[model samples]
Target: MTAASFTAGLRSALRQRFRTLALLPRLLHSFWQTSPALSAAIIVLRLLRAAQPPLVLFIGKLIVDEIILQTASPAPGPTLADWVESGRLSAVAGWLLLEFLLVATANALARIGAFVERVLTERHDNALGVALIQQVASLDLRDIEASSAQDRLQRARTQRFMGNQLLTSLLSQAQDFVSLILFVIGLLSYAPLLIVLLLLALLPTLAGEAHFNAKGYGLNVSVTPERRQMDYIQIVGSVAESAKEMKLFGLGAYLAGRFAELADKVHRGNRDLAARRTLWGSLFGAIASLAYYAAYAVIAWRALKGELGIGDLTFLAGSLLRLNGLFERLILGLTQITSQTQYLDDFFSFMDLRSTMVAPSNPRPFPVPMRQGIVFDKVGFRYPGKGAWALRDLSFSIPVGETLALVGENGAGKTTIVKLLTRLYEPDEGRILVDGIDIRDIDIAELQHQVGAIFQDFVRYHMTAAENIGIGRVGCLSDRPRVIEAAQKSLAHPLIETLPEGYEQMLGRVFARGLDLSGGEWQKIAIARAYFRDAAILILDEPTAALDARAEAEIFERFRNLSEAKTALLISHRFATVRMADRILVLENGAILESGSHEELIALHGRYAELFALQAAGFQ
Candidate 1:
């Protein structure tokens, strides 16, 4: 590396370390939130344990000193019993007993602290998981769909599982810090020079740890997208959703190879970093150890010269050894914390994101039984990262109590209209008015509550039959009457009743005891959600695409009768289905090419008539 590049790298690492340390306060607040009592208990237990180590070492010094004095004195008795009664060994005996009790107490405190930490770690993990779920739920659809947002979300989710390890490291570091302070205070009375030597010896190790930790974190960040791809491949290989295709196309080996390639790349990066860190760490550790023994020699030499007693020598030697180990531990612990803080950065950054599509402070109330109906007044929109417009100058209206059908090819912006109407994406230009009021002015929740829609690609949730339909109106999930009525409207009641558990039967093959249904049956269940919602305005986008001709006819017939007094919008490619609409609009390139009823459009011989004739001829 060039000198300039090395300087830049050092600056970047220092910045990362400081930034990570800043997150410590936030982590402490999270722990307190998880359980104030547990957090307080952990701190108290660790503090008490920290004081025991230095006190134990001091008791050892006293025991040794008392033993030497007793040995040097004249023999008080000839036997063990006599010696115990004479009081010659009394002082040494008391010191030994005190040391035993201190050691026992330290062991008990250590175990108790571990137990408390385990409980706190579990609670902290669960709390973080819930916070992540809530944060993701509040995001806008566009945010969720963006690639950059997905990477942030993945990093946040991955870091959540590291909460327990991070908590344990933090508590351990706290305990060690207190112990180091007590040890330092004791050594100051004898030789303060040894403390300075210890710091200098460990400086190299500290710098190396900080440097390698930053490199490790960078490696993990770069591999995040590949890691996500590997996980996706694993799911596809094992899940029931792709089981049929996997077997038919013999994709097992191909998927395995793809996963292996990505996994190997990640492994190589980690392996290279680990090798370098281990080499430098060993070299630094050897230097620290040599410095410690050199200090030990000085203490021994002072004792030999009669300047210090054997007790003082023993005490100083033990303190030097412990100080060496403790300081090393403290250094490594600090670096580990700084590293984990990077993960905490991911978690907090994700939580910090706010939805751009927010409701106004004083929003207009949604129209109850919409008066003038919905209108698109010269609305124009282009999807993000796309050069072409999805819709431009799209002007249209659905009058109250009218069933309007829209006919268009696949990319004619039909779905984009639905997304804009529901405020999933805001229009780049112009306004969408609901009951003559701009949709942006209406309360988002209330606006969504008043509209019911079912798209062609509906989710096959792995849940009970009733739950799948009941989720349409979550407030009425327990209303069995409403659920049954909605199912009946979609003609799904008979299919559901035939299941072993009826409405309680689990749907989809993902879970045990789940009974998977045919495409037509699932479509019927999806259609029932719109009925369950019973909103003022309903939209059915290819709602019967999975059904056969007879089933399609039956569904539309029921739809025509049920929606007679409701304001509804329909999108379908089938001319037979669109013929039931009171008004039909043929759309091409997001522009209205023809507008009329079935008979009027057929008579006008426009784009709609041409498509209708072509579809009708296929039936003949």
Candidate 2:
């Protein structure tokens, strides 16, 4: 309502208009790529449909003129049969038949065009969906995890649903535009001033539509975060994953009330816009209608003065009436397009995003038998939007075939180290070297392929037991023998064998025939994935936190044997698991406080010994 705000909104709308205009070509290119034949077919069909209205109207005029000419005949036939018998009414009959044919053809064209457009829109939707997924996948881990990036992704996803509809609207408007041009030519030949009057009458309507459309877009952008929250609440309230907790805690009513509050806010915003649009729309419509009648009055008076034929009067009247409606339609359609283009802007902008992480153009291959070891040299990192560092001045190394255990409490930079090793987050300062070469020199994919990791919060995939393990080495998903071997190593084979379908049985409760596993059982399945990888460097970050003492001991024994020839990193709070490592690292606040064998640390009575004693006391 303020002058400053209005001016700002106008500028924003103008910018959006220009940006969307730039995106139009890209949209057309996407449509063509989806299916060139279908795209061309739709355009040709619309063009044919556009030409039909003008031709049909012209034929109707001819039919009227023929009837009037026959009616004025001096020796007219007295009966219908007599008229048919004589050749006097042949011209009228011919015009009538031509008009019938044109009408039939127009109907057929309309039906076919609708069918073609439907098919095209469906194909385009599918194409856009695939592209969206691929684009998301190509983004960096940092971008995917950031809150701002998620908002952009949500907007992009919502826009995909509108893409097909926007396509249809654009093509339909193009059809209408062609018809409008033809109608304008028809009017210009007779009364050009009527066209001017119609345009003037609809100016206010056009302005109102543009302003409201811009306001609607702004409202949508502002409510995106709330809309995302509503979606999350809906999922939590409806899905099976949260059902048990929701029932036990009686959160159902709370969630429902929260959702309603957000929904009402959104509803009020939309309702206000709709009410304003309706009021202005009706008033503008009345003015347009009044202008149409005024134009008709001029034509009627001219006909009465014998300046124009009865047929001319009829043709001009019909054309003017159609032209009036056409002008209104064109204005409204153009505004709809300008509004829809904002969504197009969201989608194409998403597509334009490029990841910042880049690999060497000529990268070194991964070392199969890594020579020296892995080293982190004075590495420092801080998470986005955080002032405090997650890891700082962290320097450590694991020699070839050595099992290093990292002992750290929560927020002690244990998981952050793993994330850094996997190149999920780039260090603010320092270098990670594998085999004495900077990891940046090696291809990222190749580096990752050599390091296999299983964290505490591992994924419980809703797939078969074999697939859950096999996903770790996707190329070997069909290698049943390898999958079984990995499962056996992690003590998961016995658990899976007891299931109804064994390896083929689905895991997790997301599907109809799925069987959910307990926390300990899921941990075993997750550990199986790291074994399945068979990489040179293995990382187990509290992977057995869910297991019992006996189970944990059994799993670690097997891991020790399998990793005898492989360099590995182990992170666990349990001293029982930590004692087996070749070297123990006592980390506090992102820096190593002490390093030694378990016996040596126990002798020193440092942070490690103190933590070990505290854990040992719990068991006593």
Candidate 1 local lDDT, 1-620, one digit each (tens): 35686457667887999988888888889889989999999999989988888888888889888888888988888999889889787888888888899889989998998998888888888888888888887787788898888888999999876667778788888888898899899989888998999889998888788888899899988889998899899999999879999999999999999999999999999999999889889998999998888888888888889988888787888878878888998899888889999988888889999989867888998888677888999999898898898899989999888999989888988888888988888899999998899999998888888888999998888999999999999999999999999999999999999999999999998788999999999999999989999998889999999999898999988988998767899999988899999999888787788888999999998888888888889889
- Scored against the true structure, residue 206 in model 2 reaches a CA lDDT of 75
| TM-score to true structure, per model | 0.95, 0.95
Q: How high is the lDDT of residue 541 in model 1?
A: 91
**TM-score of model 2 vs. true structure:** 0.95
Q: Give lDDT tens digits, candidate 2, residues 228-271.
A: 99999999999888999999999999999999999999999999
Q: Which residue pairs show collisions in model 1?
A: none
CA RMSD of each candidate after superposition? 2.1, 2.2
Relative to the true structure, how large is the alpha-carbon lDDT of every model? 0.88, 0.88
Instruction: Please identify model 2 stretches exceeding 4 Å from their true place.
Output: 1-8, 74-76
Error of 2 at 123 (Å): 2.2
